[model samples]
Target: MGTHQLTTINNSDTFEDSICDLFNHLESTFTYKRFGKNGHNQKGIDVFSTEKDCAIQCKKKDLSRKDLLIKKEIFNDIEKDVNKVINDDLKVKIDKLIFVSTYKDHPEIDEFCEILKEELNTDFEIIYWGWDTLESKFLANKELLNKYWSNFIIKTDSKETHFKRNLDLKKKIAKDFGNWLNDSQANRKLRSRILLRAFDGTQYPDENEPDEFGQYSWFRAEIKSLYHKGMEFIIGIDEIQVFEDYTWDFTSNDNEPKGELVNVAKVGQINFSDIIDYDIDGDEYYMFPHVFCKFIHKGTPFENIYYYNLDKTYEYFEIKDKRK
Candidate 1:
């Protein structure tokens, strides 16, 4: 597989300029129209591809850093660009709106895009192109990679080949873990061995453990309880904050018991699949299943929160002695 440094492309301004060029190389029929260098007539649109009938906006963010832009900030940027096409006199009949960026994957992007579509009353589809997705596209087409990275010495294998190799390794681990489970008596008793370690150490607790904010140590204690019950490998997930500057009120609404408080750690949109990106607390543990259970407020729709149910029972997976 190609070992060219994509970070160099991420850190340079040329990446934004070359985005349309890269897409053109991918699809032979693609035609890119730049809004202009002066940024006067462009509105919010950056690059328009005639072949796909797509209006593309290229955003190059600091991929090395996380939470650089908040949720509203990202929404606002995309909204303005979409409006420029819909409301402007040009009436650019775009079938698809594509946003290409170098930022890490944001789970809330899909929900936010749907909200925008509903608010605008449009039928256009929204697509987000993050770093990993872009990497996949580059790997699928080496010509596109060579065109962008002039210094890249084309490797013998493609990116798809490299991905398959990694995926195969993960499957082998899962298979081995499954085999160990089938061989063990303890694991065979449990219905599900899913791990729900979402908020182990997200917050700090003080002298008085307030029920409203909840104790940060609660998750740690829960894990201990699970371990005592024969759960060996545990999986936990947390929200990657969308808004950096805003503070959420932890108080519960009038719907619940008077003194009982809602768990504030359970707030925001989280993609459990992204948990693979999280570092394990050393090699003592490994990831098995890649799934998530999202809890959202029924009244407000996309207002999602994550909370660990202390009393909930899941099928337990006893860790093999070797992993310990």
Candidate 2:
């Protein structure tokens, strides 16, 4: 409703908040919790409202069969958390496990969610808020909810107000996600990158990705060191230039000019949600997530490499001592 930016605009949290707001508006009995393999892991499990109704997340950069592994891992990870919420938190068993994310339903997602549901004995409702869901949930409300929240509530929300209100917020949030997706798609259009390394051996953040939700990222010339071993190669780049000094005429492989490269280490991105700071004690939760990552070394086929999430990147970044 307010025309301010989402401060903590994480894909998972935002998605969960939309779901939570819907449930809260409808006065549903729920509490969104952070959970995972190591006891409330939080890498996934966007919403853990009670045990009966729940929402999960698996953010991906690209929706590929590779995501099936992550989905399976997180889904199993939630079993104990969901069980605790059921037997411990709310004393009620869950009927369905709604797993939502930016990932669309491909052979991987479809096959995984169904297999996960059957294997885990929990109904996994996967929601991929791709452009389709965005248009239907947000663009659809363009005419009615543009200036009239009341009309929107009256029209779409009577029995399922939670679902309705969440859909409303989903519209706004998806706009941002769509924007990030667009940028990524644009970068992909280039189809090539020229890496520029650092002299100080300092690690830099990704370049292609400047997202509010930074689970998936790309650092164009993340100048770490002189192309030593241990650091994995990223995909889609044309060539890499490891210079002795920071000074380099960094440009596209075709000599096209882009943004000026600075000495600052481009760090991970953070995204805020519209529902941040809203009291989230009694709201149900849901999610939409996608993570696309690959490494391109020497212009050959890029290899896909999966990291946990943006948080891990930040944590790992901070823990690393400044390159000597």
Candidate 3:
């Protein structure tokens, strides 16, 4: 199951509405409603279930924008919301207060909630629901999942055929890009010159070997060939190691380079499943799949060399070095 589906909700209001809808569907006895217009004067309550005397506060935090980690600010916000709900006037007295967040569950957040409950010494029960809980709930309810995250729908006959079609389209795209890369003019323009960022896996040095700076290094390579090996798409390339003094300036047409030629041809496996649809210079829009190349370096297999499809101008491929 894709637990990251909920993270696609780009706004706080939508997230709060989703939480409200989820609880209303899950609990048949309770009927939840949005507390106020645009959550103004809500008294720390975004959703309220009057029938069950329950109050829910939704916290939407985009971890991607916030360095992909839960911080103390979230905990502090939760504490403040809990306090607001406890020490405020409302139409109906709430016996239960629930805090819902788009963030994944963390040990520190769990422990903090426990501490808050103990210190508050309230008669009502306090509950915290993170992304894990939301994901499980959405998985169980097809309608809810489809309503909120349309991308995570279950595969039916038609859906399965659509997925297969997308895969076939990606294969064609890869083949086209491979052909373009092998062209004489394209080869002359990009060979041993295009610098690509390396993939940083979850497990640091174990899964990916970084340079002395504790970060992945950009690599330059020339595509030798592209083919399908079993269920994987493989790219054959001759890796180039650039010198320390080599200045990477794409604006200038300087042909000189200070890099060593690594004549060893390596077969790297590419991932075509992750596709991103974006616009270029606010004009042209296209769907581009990320090319994750895993090749063996110095006898150790390293999953580096990230590539993406750039704009094709007059049968030549232009390298757009933008980190998505």
Per-model RMSD to reference: 14.1, 20.2, 12.7
Window of ten residues with lowest summed lDDT in model 3 = 278-287
- Please give the lDDT score at residue 218 for candidate 3: 33
Clashes of each: 5, 40, 0
Highest TM-score model number: 3
Q: For candidate 2, give the lDDT.
A: 0.35
**CA lDDT of every candidate:** 0.49, 0.35, 0.55
Per-candidate TM-score against the hidden true structure: 0.46, 0.28, 0.48
* lDDT score, candidate 1: 0.49
lDDT of 3 by residue, 1-324 (tens): 321344446687788788788888889754898888573788878888878889888887766433223556678887888888777766667888888877766666777777888899866677788878887787788787778777764544465665775578567655555544456644554432322223423432233345334544333334333433211222343334334443222222356534532222233433333322211111122123223333225322233343222222323222323222
Question: CA shift at 82, candidate 2, in angstroms?
Answer: 7.3
Model 2, 229-290: lDDT tens digits are 11222332222222344223323467554333322222222112112211112123211221
Candidate 1 C-alpha lDDT tens digits along 140-215? 6667666776565655666678566546544543453454444543354333333333332222222223222332
Better of 2 and 3 by lDDT: 3
Candidate that beats the other on TM-score, 1 or 2, i.e. the better one: 1
Query: Which number leads on lDDT?
Result: 3
How well does candidate 3 score on lDDT at residue 103? 73
